[model samples]
Structures are given as structure tokens and as C-alpha cells.
Target chain A: MKLKLTTLALGAVMAAGPVMADLVFPSLSYRTGPYAAGGIPFADGYADYFTLLNERDGGIGGVMTKLIECETGYNTEKGVECYESTKGEGALVYQPLSTGITYQLIPKVTADNIPLHTMGYGRTSAANGEVFSNVFNYPANYWNGASGVVNYLLESNGGDLKGKKIALVYHNSAYGKEPIRTLEELSAKHGFELMALPVDHPGQEQKSQWLQIRRERPDFVTMWGWGVMNQVAIQEAANIRFPMENFIGVWWSGAEHDVMSAGDAADGYKALTFHNVGRDFPVFHHIQKYVVDTGKAAGAGDQIGTVLYNRGMYAAMLAAEAAKTAQGIHGTADINAAMMRDGMEALEINEAKMADLGMPNFGPSFNVSCENHGGPGLVGVTQWDASSKTWSLISDFKPTDGDVIGALVAEDSGAYAAENKITPNCN
Target chain B: MPDQFLFATEVFINGLMAGVLYALVALGFVLIYKASGIFNYAQGVMALFAAMTLVGIMNGQVPFSHIINAVFGTEIHHFGWHVPAFLAIILTVGVMVGFAWLVQRLVMRHLVGQEPIILFMATIGLAYFLEGVSDLMWGSEIKKLDVGLPQGGSFWIEDMTAGLGSENFYGFFIDNLDMVATIVAALLVVGLVLFSQYTKQGRAMRAVADDHQAALSVGISLNFIWVLVWSVAGFVALVAGIMWGTKSGVQFSLSLIALKALPVLMLGGFTSIPGAIVGGLIIGVGEKMFEFWIGPLVGGATENWFAYVLALLFLVFRPQGLFGEKIIERV
Candidate 1:
């Protein structure tokens, strides 16, 4: 009887040992290519935050996070290859920086039961919690950004946006188009005139776009550009003597590298922000202590709390919180794709926790749910000061107009379903 | 004046600057074609490689070391070296020369007397291969490159021309780098002309250009001349790369300007030194003026296609190009 009991106890110990599984996270880094200048900081922040979490708190519930990166070189085909190779290694979520690649992989990720964290990009319509069950665009979508720009312009002119002529110089891709449909809708509702000007991929030269702006003489210019397009637009606008105050860029357009080359000329440009500015945040102090001070920083030491970096930190925070929540329920470190998804859906980074984590003006108080995947719609506006080489937030917390955004999201998702021959499973 | 008019002038100037850069790239294309019958699509990638190499060397980082570290999960910072500007320039020349010699020894030497189109395709393949190898060697991150060149506007010219009030009537502004590029390009063209017309080897190159079969029969070593032409092209690429890489910093898109040069070749007859120079200036100046005067009236951004449209029109009148040998190919 004693021998049998000892053998049973040994078997139970073996079973408990197998339960402590580490979570694997794969990163598709576009640290090269035309967009690398912007992509690298975001990636660094994302990775650094995870490292900090592991270092400071011994990982999420003792389930160590491992980051395996595959350089896509900003090519869609290469991005797909990276996804295929990493997915089998137990990838829980994907954050494709490119809209084109995100669109290509959404179906595959959905079929594979993996969630895609397209943070600030990908299908704008995926903002609808009902249609895209496996995707999330926390904070806001491109349509929200468009509305934010329009709203800002309206406010700039003392709250009446009627009869305004707005020109959009955007990259000709899904990422660029995401805002156009919303702009068109808003223009019709507010009696503003919208002109769409498309720039080709890897946009470097824009002599033509500015020329058109000169001709059209639009009251405000909203740029949905990326990579080199941002600088090109700013330079062209400066040369044309376009009033810089009237120019606004999307969230992706506001980076130091984009405007640094054009110094002074890029002043007065405003861009929307889905996350709080990290420059003055206490989290940056922690980053300095934990990452930069330790010489584990990924980029130039100075780029620790840039806008992209802050967004990356937010993403990491969401993922980590989810992991913690999942461990609380499961009572073990071992996690699978399903548990990661549940953790992601249960994230609630409120102000108290944010303050405790050293982030002030960080963002809203909300929890993700299975039926509502867009974690929050919090956004703000930041203006570029050439003198300081810094972006200062100028507006209070402004969530996306959910009423209008929801309708558009539903409409877009409907169109996507029809085209792809998939039935809407909103229920 | 109307806002459109003001806007057009700005776009025109921007277009002109872009066109000038494109012409500089085309000059390298013309050099090789003038001496050898081969059309090199690798010219752009060659420029990319040269610029990247210079940046790497200046930073005190070896190319292979960066590649090895990058592939093996090691974070490699740039060498952080502050080599003297002049030394960096000289070292870049040596690197280009070595690369040209390797190409001649390994690839170009094997494909003598091949069809011009086939040679062109081979260079295209070389372009792809070089692009991949470059990314592998230098893990793609845009670096801040300061080669001690003057940047921004020229106050001297602006002040000198202030009396005319051209600054008010048209307010034409020229960048200091533009002035430097124009001056450098002129000096290089003159040097090439003197080399080809005065030197015996240059004459041999011209003789080979005139008749490859006859030149070979007369014991002009085709292999030696091919190597020389390639080396000259490499040197030209280095100069062009420096000017461009310095202007934009050593990035991948610097090579895409190769496509922009296609129009210059069409305008300048690919075999004439004067043609290349003249073609570059015309395309540059013309695109700017067109974007300034006509761009706003039509749609504002005439620069994107202005060069291509101009080249297409020029090509219609001169199929062989402005300086190309007018071959009467009749069966």
C-alpha cells in the first residue's frame, strides 16, 4: 500500500511539471526597407516592453515570453512566409505593420484560430467587434483618424466645418484608402468638399501632389502618407508656401525622422494620436532605468519614448495584462492559443493601473470582451514643434465617434463578407 | 498672381531638381554605352552598393561583419568611427574599382559578343543579385550620413540677385547642393571628354566603340577594354552615388533613380558625352519649368510623368536617342 501511494505521488508530480508551459510570441519586424525608419522604433518598443515585463515582474504569471523575429523587408510575400514559418511554433497573435500584408493574412489567421493585433493598421472595418472576431484595432481605426482630422479642422475654424475644401494626399493602398471612405461620408454630412489624390507605393517624390494642391487651393490638407511620403508632402507644402497650420497627418505620419530633414518647414503640422505621448511619462523613466541604462535598448538611446514606442508599449501592456488575467483563471503558467485569446479579450488597463505602471494621461478605462474586440477608442491630437523636435499633445481624450464608425464598420465588413463569400457571424 | 501660379513654380523647381539627379544617374549609363555596346541595368544597384559601402566604411563597420552579426542574432551598432572625409572618398573609389574588377573577371568576361539585349538582361539579373547581397551585407536601416557637404539654400546667390527683385516677381530659390551638383557634373563631363579624346587608351575605347570586330582584328584586347569601360562606369557610379547618397543619405530608394535616368538616355543619345550632359540639363530644367508654368493648370503634379512624357516625345523623333548611332537596320 505504501509503495503504490509513492508511485501515484510521483506520477502527479510529473503531470504538474508538464503544465508549466512558456508562451511563444513571434514578431515580424520590418526593420529594413523604405519604412524601416518608422517600423524599427515600434518594434524596439514592443520588444523592450516585453523584456521589461519579464525583468521587472518575472514574466506574466511566470509564463516567460519569447520574441522570435523574422525580417519581412516590407514585402507582402515575405511577410506571408514569416507567418507560415512562425505560426507552427505556437504564435498566439500577429501584428503586421503593413496593411497589404495584414489583408492577405487575416483569412489565414482567422482560419488558424489565431488573433491578429493590427494595433494601428490593417482593415479599418475590422474595428467592428462583430464582423472580425479574430482581429482587433484597439484605440481607433483609419476612419476615426479621418473624422478626428475633420473635427480638428472644424474646431480650428471656430466650430463650423461647412463648405471647407479638404485635399487628401495619400498612399494608394488599403492603408491609404481606409480613411477616404470615411472622409467622403463626413464631407457629405458636413458640406465639406473632399478631393482625393493618390500617391504610388514607396512614395518618395511628390512634386505633382503639391502642384495640384497649389491649383485646387484647398483650405485644409489631410495627408494619409507613410515612409518617405510624409517628408515629401511637408517639403512640397513648404515650397508652395501652403499654410502649415492647415496641414494634418494621420497617426503614422507623425515621426521625428519624417520631419527632421525638413526642419522648421514641418512646424505646425498636427497628427492624431491613439496613445498618450510618452516623452514626459514616468514609464520612460522606467525604460531608461531598465532598458537604456542597462544598455539593452534596441535603437538610438534618444528614441525611447517616441509616439511609435509608446504605442508598442501599450500593445505589450495589453498582452501582458491579458496573460496575467488568464493565469488568474487557469491557476497555471501553461498557456495555449485559446488562453492567450481569452487573456487578450479580458485586458483592462485602467487609469489606476496605468498610474501604478507610471503612465499618466495614458488612456481610458475599459476591458476587452469577446463580443467587443476594439479595446478602446481613445485618441488625442499632437502638434510638431521643429524647435524642440518633440510632439506636444494639444487635445483632451477624444474617443472615436462610435455611432458613425460602427455603421461604417458594419457596412465595410458586409462588403468584405460579400466579396469573400463568407457569411457574417456577428452573433 | 494666382495661388495656382505660385504653386506651379514650386512644383516645377522640385521637378527640375529631381530631373537633374536623374540625369546624373544617366551619365553613368551613357559612359558604358559610349565605350561598350552593353546596356547595364545594374547601374542603379551598383550605385546603391557604392553608397552603402561608403556609409559602412565611414562608420568603421565592415560589411561582412554586419552581415554575420545580423544573421546570427547579434546587435551590431555602426562602427561609430569618424574617418576623415577625404579618406572616406578615396576608400570608396578603391572599393568601387575592386567591385568592377571582380565583375569583369567573374561575369562580364564570360559573355563576350552576346546580343545587346541579352547583355542588358544579364545586368538586370546582376541588379537583383546585388540588391539581395546588399541587404544581406548591410541590414536595411536608413542611417544619417553627413559627408561635410554644404546643405540648404544659397544666401550668396539670393543676395546677389536681390537687386533684380526676381525674388519677388518669381521668388526663385536654388539650393546650395544643387549648385554643387551642377558644378561637379560639369567637371566630371569635361574630365571624361579630355580622357577619351586625348589619351591612347581612351582612343582605343573609342575605336572599340566604333567597330568591335575591326578593333579586335587590329589586336585591341576586347577583354582589357571591357574591363576599362566597366571600371570607368564604376567610378562614375561612385561619384554619382556620393552626391545622391549625401543628399538623401545611403538608402535603398537611391537606386530607383535609375528608372528616372531612362528618360535622360532617351533625350541625350546614349553614346555622346555632350549628349548625356545636355540631355540631363534639358530634362532637369524643362521638367521644372513645365511643372511651374503648366503643372498647376493641369493637376499640380506634372513632375511624376513630365520627364517620362518628355522622353517619350523625344524618342519618337529620335529612335536612336539624341547621341545614339543612327543605325539604318534594313533587311
Candidate 2:
């Protein structure tokens, strides 16, 4: 009885040990709802990457990182609620992952002095950090994706795309409508006919759109779709016997789930990507050993190399690197949200850094500055091989039409600054 | 023929095919509303659950594996055996039947004499609950549902009709899956009509739907009839799920198809199966035709609201709906 009492007392004391102060990154995830299929793998990826860092590297700069996951169900209102609730938990950065939610949280995060990273999807003008200081969309944006698609087509046609009829079958929402302006500008520059087809939300029925596609027979079809919309569009494209090689989709539309349903017919479907494809990275090996093998995986461990999973892991890596930068800049391991923002603004990702992080050539090297939150806008192209059930990067990370994109970004951000009655300045 | 005219005709045919699918989804609502006064908002979620259950059984996936693994710290995901699609579908039907019985026992029986709004609210609550339960059971990943149904455009029809159009026009592109859905929906409607008109249990169901108190006084068990109606609705939901799941990968969005059926229900009236069909056809063709015609002028994407607007007009003009029984109350 005396020995048992002593053990109990020791166990109680150990169990009630001091809580460690860590860098908090709030992941506004949607693991259930209409978009849950896409959300699950991504959320899993994000959490798993942080877990990898915790297990493998003992966290960034010897300080542990805590990911506070709040379910948003892909709803804007719930996303706001998540932000409001988790913002007080010492969160250093926010990655909402949804454009609708990102748009809502922009002002809120700015007000709270937390850095918001939208990655590839959000307000393109936020790339103009002069107007929107708190928001950052690096490596690529929708305009970059649109320019990439056009660039790939131009390359295929031997640098000439005049008289080519390209159709844009897009989701009828802000996220989908984003590329229209860029494509329209590209059409004027390259002399290609651009037709925009809008598919309603939860795009289950798209017979009419596909039927029109059949009738018109555009030279190439570029889709800006998400979730069920992507699957249905791919299936419909397959059904109409559209040449799979001629069909291209945004990164959001290119995933294993989107084309797997169509079987072999989805072969050769192309999508514009900003990062490398597949599980060839050295970091994945470490992740497998530390995260999956240890049963600390954020998901089923089956999504380790999947596209969205890799994207999520990439996002987490960027956040970690930024945190490391903050630690270096502040001369302290412990960093606050404001310090994180400064670090993000000063962050630079190069080939050497990526190689050191074990994700050599995983993505393009770029620098984020006070004036430019978005990266070099370099994009790559990927092709789906249905038989092998894999996506292979077929094109190198190449520059987009920065002249047109820059002008548009400046114009839009300028208008935004004017409307908000704010002085646009790097200071 | 002019290319524009040929395109319009193609759109009309596709619209008819699309209507068959809409009617298939709405049929479940009509069945439940006819048998009971309660409008089941969970009908779409039922379809999602049924599809996920079917896929899970076919793939030999362990149900609630995510939760089980989380709690036990184990990594058991599958059963190491894949069930044949035919048997898996049968098993799924059995599960849905069990679900119907559970819903009747746990939910409907308690709300027997409740107001219509209360029952409706109960179904809305059931929708969220079933959605969460389905996600927990299936792991919330998009699953491909292939019951060996034919897919892609009908090549024979495309080839045969290509000559009838302008050289630029390829042909009428009709999906083989849509064709299968139409046939299945037709067979289902015929079978339902025959069962309700001929079988003794079906007669009991109709009698109960007519006047629950009167049917109870005449030896018909309200509990059994409600369970039967729910089971039939569950079967309808399964069929709709299979069709839509095959068209699009089975995912959480499968539950939102119920929203599409609402306008169908409002236009068809909640009590008539045939009305559901006609209403579905009208809405489908109207929306498609309107989108094909006036959508471009208005910047396209008119399919979402066109059906609701037409249904609203119907509600204002014909509250009982076409083919619906007109209610008469004596003061």
C-alpha cells in the first residue's frame, strides 16, 4: 500500500508537469462537409508535417510547434469563428486554405497582426504587399496559374497560339472567376479565342456545358474547378470523347480523386502546378519513418505522397522556414505574430535552402519582400498517367507573363488601396 | 438543319435525360411525404450514406476504422477481402433497411403526433447527424463507385446522328450512364406504382397515409407501415446514390443533391410520385433550355436559380401542383 501510494504520487506529479511554450500555427481545416475530401488530405498533410518537425528535428530552433486545428467545414462563417477562437491561443500564423475564408480573415488577421498565408489561392492583389501587408500568397497565384496554362499551350504550338479557340469551364464563384481577367488579357496578347463557361456550385450536372463543348469543339479546354466540379468536368470531358491531351486544369482540379473515377479515359489530362509532383523528395522518407511508422500521422498514412498532401506539407514547410527566419531576426527562439510577419516579409527560399531541408527542387526558389508578397510567379505543368496512377511534372518551373500580370496587380491593388483610403507604402 | 437548331434539339434530349435523374432523387421525398406528413430533409444524406456504405462494403473497408484506430491506437483499415458489387449492393440495402427501422423506432415513433414543423426539424437534425456519422464511418475521402455500369457517350448514337448535322457538329453526346439512369428510374417508378396499387402491405401503407387514426383503428400497424415506407425511400436513395456516385465520385457533396430535389418536390407536390417525374422533367428541361438560350446574355450559370424560380411560380399559381390531389376543408 505504501509503494502504490508513492507510485501514484509520482505519476500524478509527472502527469501534471509544466506545459511547454511553443510556436502556435492555427490550421483552419475542414475535415467534414462538401469539400471534406479535398480538406481531409490537406489538413492531414499540414498536421503531419508539423508532427514530422516535432518528432524528427525536435521542432524549429529547438522550440516545439503546436498546430491548433479548427474545423471550418469549408464554410466562410465557420472559418471566421475558428479564427476568432484560435487567434487568442498565441497563434503566429494563419493558413485558412479557402479563398472565401481567406478573404474574410484578411482584415481580421491584419488587425490582429498575424501573418496570413494563402499559398496559391486568395486575392491575387494581396501579392502587392504594399496594399495588403498581412496577406502572403507565394510561389504562385491564380493569375500565375492562368498564365502558366497559356504558356504551356503556347509552348506546345511552337510559341504561336493565334486563332486557337480555348474554353475556360470554371466554377461560378470568385475562386473560379479569378483567372478570367488574366486569360482575357492573354487572349488579347496572343490572339487566342477565349470562351468562359460557368458551372454552378456543387457542379453535379454539367451536361449542357459539355454538350456545348462538344458542339463548339474548342482547341483546348482549361478548367477552374474544385471538389465534385473537378470530377464531373473530367468525367464529362471523357464522356464527350474530348482529347484528354487537350484538356488542362488548375492545380485545384488536378488530384488523384478528380480523374480516378474516369479510369483510363482520364489519361494524359494536364494540369498547371507550381511545385514538384510525386513522393521522390527526401523529406517524405523522414516523414514515413517519424510520422507514419510511429503512428503519429495526421491521416491514414496512405496520403503521404498525394498531391494535396504534398501541397499541405509544402505549406507547413514554408511556415516552419518563416518561423526559423523570425527566430534568427528576433535573436530569440520565441517569436510573436508580429515578429512572424516581419520574418515572412524578409523570407527567401533558394535552391540551397530547399536542398538543406531535403526537398531539393521540390519548388521554385523565390523571395518575399515588403512590396511583393507573391513569389516569382513561376509555374510548372503536370500530366496524369491513369495506368500508372501518378502525376509527373513534365515542364520546368518557368516564368509567366509578368508584364501583363504586374500591370493588372498594380491596377487592382491600387483601386483597393484607394477604396480603403489607405496609403500604399512599403514602410 | 441549322447548327443552332441541331444544338437546341441536342440540349433538349440531354435535358430529358437529366430530368430522369432529378426525378429519381425526388422520388424518395415523394414516397416519404406520401406515407407520412413529415418532409425528410435527410433524404440526400441518406443517399450519401448509402453510397459510402456500398463503396465501403465493396472495398472491404472496415467501418468506423478511423475512430476505432484513433481510440485503440491500431491501424486496421480493411478486411483483406473485396465483396462483389452485386452482393455489396444487396448488403448495403440490408443496412439501409436496418437504418430505416432504427429511424422509425428512435425518431418517428416519438414524434407521431407532433406538428409538421417539428417533424421537419427532426429530419433536419437527422441530416446533420447522419452526415457526421457517415463521415466517421467512411473516412471522408472521395471513393470511385463502379458497379460495372457503362460510361462515356453512346458511340453508336453519336456515329449514327453525326451525318444528320452540319459537318462541324459532331453528334448528340449522350452519356451511357445517363441512359442507364433513365432505364433504372423508369423500372423503379413502374415497380413502385405496381407495388402500391397491388400488394396488401402497399394497400396498408396507402390506407395509413390516407388517415393514420382511421388506419390504426382498422388493424393496420402505423409502426410497420412507416418502417416499410422509410425502407422503400431508402432503396430509392440508394439507386439515386449509385447513379450520381457513378457520374461524380462519391463524396460529401452527394448529400447536397437533396437541395436539387427540393424545387422538384415543391413543383410536384409532396404526395404524388408521377408529379415528381413530371416536375423533374419540366424543371430540368426548363433550366437547361434557359441556360442554353438566355444564359450567355446574362453571363451564364442560370441552371441553379432557374429551377427554383419556375418552382416558385408554380407554388404561387398551383399550390397543390399538377397531378396533386386538391385538398378540401369544410368550415
Candidate topping lDDT: 2
Model 1 clashing residue pairs (backbone): A208-B301, A211-B300, A212-B300, B8-B292, B269-B322, B269-B323, B269-B324
Model 1, span A1-427: residue lDDT tens? 9999999999977765423355667778888667777778888888888777667777777767777788897789999999998887777778878888898888898789788888778888876555677787775668778888887777778978788899999887778888887888888888899988777665665555665676567999999988877766776677667888888899898877666656677798888887777578887888888877776666545667788878777777777777677777677677766677667766776889889887866866777776567755666788889998788888976766667777788788888878878776654
> Model 2: how far is B154 from its true place, Å?
0.8
Runs in model 2 deviating more than 4 A are A1-20
Clashing pairs in 2: none
Cα lDDT for residue A241, candidate 2: 84
B-chain TM-score for every candidate: 0.90, 0.98
Lowest-scoring 10 consecutive residues by lDDT in candidate 2 chain B? B165-174
Q: Candidate 1 DockQ category?
A: acceptable
- lDDT for model 1: 0.75
lDDT tens per residue, model 2, B112-226? 8999999999999999999989988987889999999999988998898888867987877788988999899999999999999999999999998899999999999999999
Query: lDDT, candidate 2, residue A264?
Result: 90
- Candidate 1 on B2-49: residue-level lDDT in tens? 544554555556555666667678878987887777788999888888
What lDDT is reached at residue B230 by model 1? 82
Q: Note the Cα lDDT for every prediction shown.
A: 0.75, 0.92
